[model samples]
Structure formats: structure tokens, C-alpha cells
Target: MSGLDIDRAAATQMAQKYRNAAEDLESALGGLPASVDGGIASGVLADIVSTLAQNAADLAVLSRVMGGVIDATVSDATATDDSVSESFGGLTLPGEEAAP
Candidate 1:
């Protein structure tokens, strides 16, 4: 069977990119106000913006969490791979029988 092939470095880079996107989103949304000073139209616009901001904040948090999860998962996978490799250090493959 074909084995799993994960690029640990690429996964790490993707995780970092997610975190960076989160940071960028939060930074961009930091100064938006919940309410504005105009009339009914302004109030409606503010409400929309407020809702969007909240959703964006939630998305940012999710992105950061996903990044952390990816990093942790990759680390765990690497550790498990290392442990498995070590466990099989002296073993021979099925077809590579030793001379009697």
C-alpha cells in the first residue's frame, strides 16, 4: 500500500499563513464603531458593520485556533513518526530475509 506523505515544512508554513491572516483581519477591524452619528440609514449601516465585525472577529479566532491545531498535529505526527522509526530500527523488511 502507498504510505502517507506529508510535507511537515509546508504544513508549518500554511499554519503560519493562517495565523498571519488572522492577525491582519483583527488589525483591520480594531477601530470600527458599533454605532454611527447619522440617522436611520446610518444606524442600519452601523448595525451591519457591527455584525460583520463580530463575524470577522470570530473568523479570526477560528483561523488562529486552526493554525495552532495544525502546528500541534504536525508536531505530534513527527514525534509519532520518530517513535515508530526508532521502534523499527533493527527490523528487516518482509522480503529482506537474513542469511541463515
Candidate 2:
């Protein structure tokens, strides 16, 4: 009902779409061998690999977007009376802090 709710819904839809796309790509790849009578040509295989890689990249972006949306929604829900720092614990870079 709210803007945050809308964003969460949209993110969920986008994630589902990306999952569908990935499944379709996998199915297409599975069918490739059947489509080619003999073994797949080197050039054709290279092209297929390139396309698959791009699809994978898209999936990654979609996943990241979904995660960001969830994070935003959570932050918004918890941020009414708190500072951003408090709402999100604390920011720390991967290698900036030593492991405990």
C-alpha cells in the first residue's frame, strides 16, 4: 500500500523474472546439443558461451537489485526513530577490518 511496499513488490517480481530467464537459458543450452546433428562447431559453442555468460550477468544484477530492495525496505521499516548508522548497524569494508 505504501511506496516501500510497492518497491518490495517490484523487486520480488523482477527477481522472479530473472529466475525465469535463467531457467529458460538453461533449457536452451540443454537443447543445443540435440539441435546440432553432429558435435557443435567451435565458433558456435563460443557464441553460445558468450550469450550464456551475458545471461548469467543479468541474473547477477537482478539478484543484487532484489537484495538492495529488501535492504531498503528493512531500513525504512526500522529507520523511523533511528539514525541510518543505528538502523544498519555499522559499515565496514571487507578487508578494512581484521577478522575476529
Candidate 2 runs further than 4 Å off: 1-40, 81-100
Per-residue accuracy of model 2 over 1-100 as CA lDDT, tens digit each: 3453345566556656756665665556555443433365866876776677677667766756666665666557556536755655565678776334
lDDT of 1 at 40: 60
* Superposed Cα deviation of residue 82, candidate 1 (Å): 0.2
For model 1, the local distance difference test gives 0.89
Top candidate by TM-score? 1
Superposed Cα deviation of residue 9, candidate 1 (Å): 1.0
- Give the alpha-carbon lDDT of every model: 0.89, 0.60
RMSD of each: 3.4, 13.6
For candidate 2, the lDDT comes to 0.60
Per-residue lDDT of 97 in model 1: 75
Q: Roughly what TM-score does model 1 have, to 2 decimal places?
A: 0.83
lDDT of 1 by residue, 15-98 (tens): 999999999999989777646876768878888888899999999999999999999989988998899888877688798975
